[model samples]
Target: MAGAMMLALADGGSFTLEWTHSVEREDWRETWEVTEDHRLHLTEAAVKGSGAGMEPGPGGHFEDGWWVWAPDLPPVPALTLAASGETPSAWTLCGEDCTQLGATSGQPVQVAPCPDAG
Candidate 1:
């Protein structure tokens, strides 16, 4: 399985993130919106399997500048976002087993193609 988080600067100084995971020939995507106050909102979630479901709750927050999102789903990667100079710009997707799928450093984010993806 592989996972990644794409970050972009939204209008009004907020941010938008799209977290995606590919496993078992299926893809799971979670869309989020971060406010200027650092509050995260789970705007939408979709999965190829009917067994997969996400519960929206207190979502996430920025800790010292890095945005952290920890959900109750197993095997789902954790999302973290950090800034380079002033704004939150970089992100990392860490699997539950501690495997890091991808990360970014200020430029356009890209998920390293997973050889095992299917």
Candidate 2:
């Protein structure tokens, strides 16, 4: 719960976060959805290339030029990301529209889901 943030989600809606590995120079992506209990659930993950320490998780397979898999993780109240301004590429968060998280460097960004108002 460090620096927690509460974000409202659309009913059964999902979001995507994409980033590039600093050393591997490959693209990584994760698809997350809001659970019924208003928590963040990681549904899928993909990597454009693999290297040392960049291998896909279990049950992963190459598809459409990317290694894709579903991460077997439990839903959580929030998700935290590192923002040390050290990575070669910045993080991109997309829902309705994609937005860069570059301005959040030097601190951590926490993402959580709030129950839909409807």
Clashes of 1: 0
Q: What is the C-alpha local distance difference test score of each model?
A: 0.36, 0.82
Q: Report the lDDT tens digits of candidate 1 across residue range 32-60.
A: 44434434444544444332333222464
Model 2, 69-104: lDDT tens digits are 999999888887778788877788898877777544
Q: Give the best candidate by TM-score.
A: 2
Q: Could you tell me how far off, in angstroms, the CA of residue 78 lies in candidate 2 after the best superposition?
A: 0.8
Consecutive 10-residue window with the lowest summed lDDT within model 1: 89-98
Q: What is the lDDT of residue 99 in candidate 2?
A: 71
Error of 1 at 97 (Å): 29
Candidate of highest lDDT: 2
Candidate 1: which stretches are off by over 4 Å?
A: 1-8, 11-23, 52-78, 81-118
Candidate 2 accuracy as TM-score: 0.84
Error of 1 at 79 (Å): 2.4
| TM agreement with the true structure for every prediction | 0.31, 0.84
